[model samples]
Target: MRTSIVAVLYVGGWALFAWLGDSWWQLLVAVALAVVFTQLGFLAHDLGHRQVFRTRRPSDIAGLIIGNFGVGLGWGWWTTKHNRHHANPNHEDHDPDVSPAVIVWSEDQVARSSGLPRFISKYQAFWFFPLLTLEAWHLHIASFKALLQPTAKRRGLELTLLVTHFVLYFGLVFAVLPFGKALLFLAVHQGLFGIYLGCSFAPNHKGMPILTKEDELDFLRKQVLTSRNVHGGLLTDVALGQLNYQIEHHLFPNMPAPNLRRAQPIVERYCQEIGVDYLQTGLVTSYGQALRHLHEVGAALREPTREPTR
Candidate 1:
């Protein structure tokens, strides 16, 4: 209901602005759209978790609409990946989120990295935000690749909706704006969307513990120890889609975003009783910790390469 209202408003508002025609000022609208896109992404995430719908069919239907149709993300692919993250949190072997890629998350990953990734790891903390500008494009590419796989579920529907999204999105932008302005709008819109979405997810588990198969942690400990919550009020809650309460969210993945805040204290108290370390920090500090972890992970790369002794 509330999400429907927001979707209507976003579509109507975007249509109104597009109808008004191209102007340099539409870049501002692009910025605003980026924020809304992040919010919509969060909503899609909740849908994937079945927070909005208890049944699998309804949740997948809504997720496809919000993710594939609305945001050009592949619902099937994202949910598959996200569910694994939930099952394992930050497990080095199982969690896709922390997998070795552009940024190495652990020392073992650093050792495996070579070429560009290895070089980039040395300065990843500094390049983090700038690199996020490409995150949206990376996601889109991954979605297409996933749909192309033979094992992809509902491959036909996912591919059709994803293709339709690109056509409609590009067609609408080019129809309303000059080529140059349209390109600028896309750059700003996608770039900021990536950054905002990345920022929201980064604080949750980036700097927290990275688990491996050797670490035999209970479900509660695995989720709690590997997630960090950000401290803030209403504005932060809205901006982060209540992901500020990451510990609570991880523990209760299906809990609606609104209820995470209410669950926080209860979760925290239980953690206390069990002697688990509940990490909650300010937003800025959370990012700092994440960045510091990135830097620390790359520390070995930053060292002088040792020459082999004959």
Candidate 2:
């Protein structure tokens, strides 16, 4: 079957579940939809990076429209930051999305984010949105910084695209469902989207050791050490968009999910040949690893020895 057909089937099936799931059985289906939306989030993220389709314009337009509700955040803004992420996965100065230091003091930053905003930036980094759209907020800030480059001015376009995306997208979701239902769904969907974003972005270099000032950036080494593969089950791959095989996706971002299954072996072989670590596990295992890493991360920052001297 064509990948497009498979995609439509998966998406269409979820729509059915979401619309008609009035019985107790719906909860089970809701769990399935949660997984599907996460995979969809990955595909949309892939599409945003032009790793899925050959032509980028249509994908960009679709990303602006279809992906807005889920991992939408800001399309134009995300593209810019995503490129930087791929380039410098863990560089503290370069990568704005994830910083190990965690203590930020920017004169330019608006009066030290506090209250809800501070909570979101610090603790909510993994789950700013149930639907992962607020990821655009992170992406937008990163993109705007990238836009500051004399060559590329993208901040304006990013905002315009996102605003247009909001009107059309929320318009449709609420148009079909009740206002209360829409907000509720938005809360739920965005929350789950946040879950999807958590698994999608965090596994790649988030909890891993930070790069040194002289750390060399090699392709396979970076993919192996910095990336991880989750879940081996077939069903998990379908719904999770091969996010379980994150190392493979990072190595070949253009490979589709189906091909990603095959690509894993090839990547594993190369990693083995080079004696690099290939972290592969079941879905729950990977999730636990990330959670544990986050805990370790929090503790590491809080250590009395590690704390900055007054």
Candidate 3:
């Protein structure tokens, strides 16, 4: 019930902003609501895995409703990709989401022969979201792919959810508010939400070693290899939707964002006992580091290594 209420509040807030709201303060409120919807992505993520709500039916309903209504993320596809990512964090083949988002890894043989090309490759990638609005690109591509997916036909709710999303978005974009103001509100709101999602998610797993299949022989091993946490102050936490604590969240997907701090010590001890490298950093320092590491990811991918189990 709480989750459902949260979902409604998110959409409701968006509606309020899209209609009568005005000024920078209202824009911030809209951004906050959008952030809530974005964070709902994480909630659905946990629920999809049945780690949040536990009951399969309830969790699935929660995930599907939030995913479709709040973020327009295809629940099935997101789950497939996310589970695979957990199973194989950075394996080039198994983990399709092993992003080139930032040039964080070291360059390999392929990049060495080239200079400007190498730099450009990394530079363009690091700026993927910021430079050219890759969020828009991703949404378009993902929407198209999901719509055409044969599996989507079997997963009947996808189209309904997407159409509802369109109705909501378009209703705000055209029917509800004045066109000019609505576009402006949507633009600012999306900008903040996009940065929020990208910063929170990209830094979570990006700089971590893109481990191979063999590295993730077990669940515990995969958690250690695939995940790390970031810690920042209250403002950063609020802005990033408490996702700076990425490693902790990954380890305990069911835990709400607000409780991560209290859970940190416990998670840290576990990481220590397991000998896991609990990667963590504060806002500015880690922010700079994440950017640098993103540029070097392509470099890391190319290092010579024996193949692992696929």
Candidate 4:
């Protein structure tokens, strides 16, 4: 398959770079590796959604190999989390992606916050991209933690693959490069990996409406209203892994990445016919909208705390 061939090429490239190690230029390889890992993540996403394979068994096998072995991400854990996000894209309560953690997504969450999270929420919009540099580490940690949970399926297998990936990955870097350069390589690679991956997903639903229990809506409206699409051509499609068409992707989660673009016009027209709001914007505009929303949500935190009038 084409995907398999491309994956092989990426691995070969990494091997070649590893062999040619001990130069500052390896930092560039780190950048390329970050992009490579993100592409693997996209492929894993497709496998998770059964876009590539008809049966769950084949999909799970490929997902585990590509996700855990290839990208050092736990496929089981990611699928569990991602499935919940798809089931409820922007639901403040149900969606783990939007749930109050480091950054509060909703004003209600802002009220309940305290300590470090509260401080972060105050200027989350400003801190958003910078914070994304750590997103790779966050995901890696979360994946390991998920494997320890009782609910994790195939715990042994996933653990083995994950441990092996870290071992081989770290061993290779430290083996070939000096300790200083290895650290530098890791910083650049993981930081850019997180930023690039975060950028790809951020524009999908970040600025869109957040739903609550009281806000009842049908499936069609729920997905279309909460999702935003980015307008671009082939380059954009390849870069974002077809995620630029978030509305169509959300509506048809199992749709192949390539087909999502084809489905976009038809989906857009139907939404128009039904008088549903179809949100789409350019890439930079989409980030601006998301950041603006974050700023607006954190507005209350920016106000000086009032003292009791006694």
Local accuracy by lDDT, each model: 0.90, 0.57, 0.63, 0.90
What tens-digit string does per-residue lDDT give for candidate 4 at 4-79?
7659767876887777889988998898899888988899999999999889999999999999998899999999
Q: RMSD per prediction, one decimal? A: 2.3, 6.1, 5.4, 2.4
lDDT of 1 by residue, 99-185 (tens): 877888988888888887888888899999999999999999999999999999999999999999999999999999999999999
- Order of all candidates by TM-score, from best down to worst? 4, 1, 3, 2
lDDT value, residue 101 of candidate 4 = 79
TM-score of model 4 (CA atoms): 0.96
At residue 50, candidate 1 shows an lDDT of 92
| Candidate 4 global CA lDDT score | 0.90
Error of 2 at 150 (Å): 12
**lDDT by residue (tens digit), candidate 3, 1-310:** 4456666778677666656644445666656765686667667766766766657778777776777666777776777678777656666556766543433233442244255444455344555556433463365358558767776642667767866876777675556556776776667666666666666677666656666434535666566556656676787775566667766666766676678788888878887897866767666566676566655554433344622112
Question: Candidate 2's residue-wise lDDT over 206-305, tens digit each?
Answer: 5554554577868767656766677658777655666667777777766766777788888788878878888877666665665565444434234546
Worst 10 residues of 2 by lDDT: 101-110
